[model samples]
Target: MTPIVRDFRPDDAEAVAAVRRAALPFMVTTPEGIAFEVDQASPAARYRLLVAEEDGEVTGTARVGLAHQSPTPGQAFVNAYVHPGHRGRGAGSLIVTTAEAYLAGEGAAQVYSWVLDEPHFRTFAERRGYRPSRPAHFLRLDLSNGELPPLEEPPAGYELRAAADFADDPRPLFEAEAECTADEPSDIAAELDDYEDWLADTWSHPDLDRDLTMVAVADGKVVAFSAARTDGHTRYASGMTGTLRTHRGRGLARLVKNHSLHRARAAGCTEAFTGNDADNGPMLAVNKWFGYDICATEVRHVRELG
Candidate 1:
């Protein structure tokens, strides 16, 4: 059956999530999360969720959008995934072609995609005119059976709190996140200056597990955090974990992430996942200390539009 590409509909949320789970099990994806992304996307993002249907079944999906918050312009991204069972069909190709055309029409000058480091996936991206850029690793932790580092009490003048603790006023958390994000290593730099957008896109996200998202406070201000996202079932993922520059080397990152993992396990989560840039030795070492094993690697690929 020939594959056909089309815009995502509300009812396609479940199928899209299913495809994502099948293609990348390390990441948490849910129907509610999918719906939230489509419904809450800012107009500046020019976001489009494309689905490739074959014989009336969603075989592949692509998330196409501009890097609206990036300091640079004309930057866009397309993450296309096909169910393992559906590979070699035209689904992936159709989805990528459609995504590129849409991004081009939206005035994108360059497009980026993350291709799994496996041979076939790399070949697919190269054939589509993408060149290798940065690499990252996906790590997995066995929350149910693996022994998590014992939780430790915060040092004097510092306290640990759940993200929910900031429900009334999350600006403190946002400030910390923006500071940490600015220091993160990325090919496309993003500046989180819009507090309202952060509230809508991050604080109110459906998958954000506030109870499991741990925050570290010093002098009554947020200094570090481990943002968590859960599937509302057995899967949990670290959306972002970082510490303010001045607070680094104080073990805050480990403190917050370990605390979150322990709480997530107690809350019945069986699996935990996170991604780290290949060159980020500190974070990679941190995850290693938490007994996370590298499960998969992805290489960022970029193509410049003429």
Candidate 2:
């Protein structure tokens, strides 16, 4: 039977997460996180999660939407992945076609995707008119076996805390996240001007491990943070690790992340993973210091959808 592509249902969350795990094992996601993403997306995002089914079995999934945080207009993305065993079944093509059509209808003039850095993957994207742009690396650490850096006390006047400490008022953390995000290297500049949106899309995310997310406070201000996400099983991932501009030279980024890693290991996490843009040298160096090895690479591909 020919594969049929349709909007993802609440029941499809687990299957979609399964497909995501099979396609990109280094990235951590949960079934509830999948549903949260769809439900919390802003209307301007035009988010749609689509699934491709064959014989009543889900074989692929796609997430397509406008880049709502990007200040640039007409920027969008469609990332589609087919399970390794389900490749060559035309599901990828059908999902991409539907995703592009949806983005175009939302007034997107350009769509970007991340293609696995392999010969066939590159060829497939090029065949569909997507041209390669920036490259990124997926790094992995064996939290179960590898020795994590021992936790150390923060510098004078700096205290280590978890995100949970800010449960009553997280505006300070939100402000820090926005400032650090704006300074991070990226193809599309992100603007986090909406505090309420950030609260819905990130702070309250089901996958965010508030206890494992470490922060560095100096002068009672959120200066550095290591955002952590877990699958509630064995996998732990760094959602983002950054320090305020004024705190960069103080090694606060390393301090918070190291503390968080120790917390994760103590909590029984067996694996850790993170992604880095090729040009982000500082963060890459930090990951390397933690003994993370490059497990895979993906090249950003952009297509003008005039």
lDDT of each: 0.95, 0.94
Give all candidate RMSDs, comma-separated.
Answer: 0.7, 0.7
TM-score of 2: 0.99
Candidate 1 wrongly placed segments (more than 4 Å): none
Residues 98-119, model 1: lDDT tens digits:
9999999999999999999999
Which candidate wins on lDDT?
Answer: 1
How would you encode candidate 2's per-residue C-alpha lDDT over 31-110 as one tens digit per residue? 99999999999888999999999999999999999998999999999999999999998999999999999899899999
Error of 2 at 1 (Å): 1.7
State model 2's lDDT. Answer: 0.94
> Per-prediction TM-score, please?
0.99, 0.99
